[model samples]
Target: MRLPKTAHTSRPWLIHEIAGDFQVEDVWALATPGGPGDLPRLVSQFVSGDFPRGAPLIVRVLWATRWRLGALFGWDRPGAGLGSRVTSLRQRLPESVPPGPGPANLPFTPLYLLADEWAAELANGTVHTVMHVGWVPDGAGGHRGQMAVLVRPNGWFGAAYMAAIKPFRYAFVYPALLKRIERQWHAGTGGAPPLHT
Candidate 1:
């Protein structure tokens, strides 16, 4: 479910230390309920990029449209992405933190991984954004996932792009993706065995 901005801001997340310049774009309480150990599963599933495959048709269409638009406008070209348009957040990460397992399904680059949290990033002409997923106590003696998106807009085009997509993301993309995650959770496919240290 969509959550208030405070739902993300109230927590003292590690992301805050590194991404102080970014703005919180959205926060949602995921529907994947399970034990704390399930966090790895959630992260794994997200990295797999399966949600978009099962998302509603409208979402798929929108995604395709966005990609096409990006290509046509040179919005997602190499020069507009990470290490070019903006330096990666990995440069600011503490040495103690290990890089994430990497993304399989999305265009994002893994930033860092922790016991209960994972982060990945994406950059283009429009913005450099981070997707952070964390496990949180659900107040019922169990745990669920929470997802937040943070972004640093590139400039006027970036801000305009974000504004243009906000309604579609909230109305179609996120809701469809969340529902898919809930289904995966109930089906016991939302997670994987914990990664060995």
Candidate 2:
């Protein structure tokens, strides 16, 4: 779906799904070019507020490590592994690991199970959706895009649950996180711009 900006707003963004002919139930058999159908399920962990708000950094680190490791072991398809990584990371975190950074000495029992399930299911194939949310200023301006991948597991409610979180993620979380990253990027390059906010 393409959402165009009106006179009131400067940024215009588009949300589109790139997929081939395939049943939602059989999405796992779909190929990479079809995009991931499961992403919404994984992203729901963040959008539903099931997780505390202060741990994006830790979540990000864990996600990266998990994907790298999964790929190294050949348990996941290189293309589909990213989404599985996010899902697996969320499953690994104990309800006890506070959102903000701290000692994360939690055991890896749950994570191992998650990894095992993903590996078993993926033995056939994995499906993934790479959602790209872009922000473009009013016409004749520079534009940028922030991309995210979603991996969905089976079930109707699970798929619906994942789809529901997409809009909120675009409206809030991703934008804020991108802004934070840009600020740090500027600060490291030379110094932060004088604060006006």
lDDT per model, in order?
A: 0.79, 0.29
The estimated TM-scores of all candidates read 0.93, 0.27
Runs of candidate 1 exceeding 4 Å displacement: 190-197
Predicted structure 2: lDDT: 0.29
For candidate 2, write residues 98-192 as lDDT tens digits.
32211122111111112001111121022323222222232334322222232443346435634554464455444444454344333432111
Q: Which segments of model 2 are wrong by more than 4 Å?
A: 1-127, 133-138, 146-155, 163-172, 188-197
| lDDT of each residue in 97-146, candidate 1, tens digit only | 98877666556888898877888888888899888888899999999999
Superposed on all Cα atoms, model 1 deviates from the true structure by an RMSD in Å of 4.3
Per-prediction backbone clash count: 2, 9
